[model samples]
Target: MGTSFQDKSALVIGRPSGIARAVVEAALAEGAEVVAAGRDAQKLRDGYGDAVRAETVDVTDDASIQALAARLGPVDHVVTTASARARGLLGDLDRESLLQSFNTKVIGPAMLAKHLSITESFTLFSGVAAFKPAVGYLGVAITNGAADFLTRSLSLEMAPVRVNAISPGVIDTGIWDALGEPGKAEYFEHFRTHNPARRIGTVEDIAQAVVFAMTNRFLTGVTLRVDGGEPLT
Candidate 1:
């Protein structure tokens, strides 16, 4: 977090809100030149203002990812926080939804790792749902599980260049806004008492974990469980 990021270039691809946006802000604060890319160009610009170079890339599309890689010649660090959630029980799960989830969280990043000229480290996103499955988390579980696997295998394949994954707990990213205030509050309240952390996670928690993964050259081929002991309880 100190001079590690200073004078370095980073490519952060994800949505402009929640964990992605927070990572961008954190990298900028660390004096890294950050290029923020996501599916939404306007939101990326709006979220980061003049602080970042906003661009567009859809993780589900290989061509889009390839094009983005071509545009970004080289970078010291690359972090992909993009993910898609298909919320349905196994019985109701559709093939396309499951495929899309894997494509975004796994395959897309796999392509990114293959094409991007990453000099320092590459960080991907995973979630506690992979280990702690819920009623409608079939898609989340498998996709996140695959992402963690990718982190390990890629670290070996891309040796000398660190590869890590960040597995976050239920964080207060605006993702819960879809459930409305009452539902979100009730959901958080339940986790507040259920998890050993006794509180929900924040975007900063995951962002700082990413910074650690990027700066610590020796830490590689592992998934950093920044879930605040959510899987323990």
Candidate 2:
């Protein structure tokens, strides 16, 4: 394959999740030195080993993100999978719930781009919710929509740092554990019928999309949807 991240280092956040892990792994596999960060230091270490430098980071906190950026040194790329799993309809969602979710996904990644001198490319996680709305997903849609706009706008101000977002649909990233058994089963059944792919997404699938955007050099201020054509149908 051709080089996408030639002679560069990458700083990846939220390495605990499958999608984040895959992005870090793909960056490494592409010959980039990775400095991976997550809330769980031991987990990052355990998951990535010595080949990937690990840092303890909570993306929701400014200090934690600053410390992470400082530790990672100058980087040629930045990517985040730092969102929390919280879902509710607007009527049922409280201020704290909304803020907490945005704090992780919206504010966190935006702060990273503002504070850190990310290289030519920066990638943040959006979701299909940004465009295709569903019931009980108002909070996610708002936060992700905000993130998409922020990513695009930041790309202009950040200049050479081409900022973009990835909108993945229903990736089977063990995040379903938060939904409990019944909710999880319900989600699977819903996707089995509604999604065009007839299955859930893999982390590697999202990872490859991220890697493509980061290294493509021409893509910026865009949200690449890796949803297996679910939104089309």
Candidate No. with top TM-score: 1
Runs of candidate 2 with Cα error greater than 4 angstroms are: 1-3, 178-186
> Residues 25-138, candidate 2, lDDT per residue (tens digit)?
798888887888888889888887798888888878888878776766678898988886458866788888889889999888888887777767899888998888889998
**TM-score for each predicted model, relative to the true structure:** 0.96, 0.91
Whole-model lDDT values for every prediction: 0.90, 0.84
Clashing pairs in 2: none
Model 1 spans with C-alpha error above 4 angstroms: none
Query: Candidate 2, which ten residues in sequence have the lowest lDDT sum?
Result: 1-10
Candidate 1 residues 1-233, lDDT tens each?
55669999999998888898889888988999999998888998888899999888998777887888888888899999888788888899999988989999999889998888899999999899887887888789989999999999999999899999999999999889999999999999988898988999999998999999999989999999988688888
After TM-score superposition, what is the CA distance of residue 170 in candidate 2 from its true location, in Å?
1.1
RMSD of each: 1.2, 2.1
Model 1 accuracy (lDDT, Cα): 0.90
Candidate 1 has a TM-score of 0.96
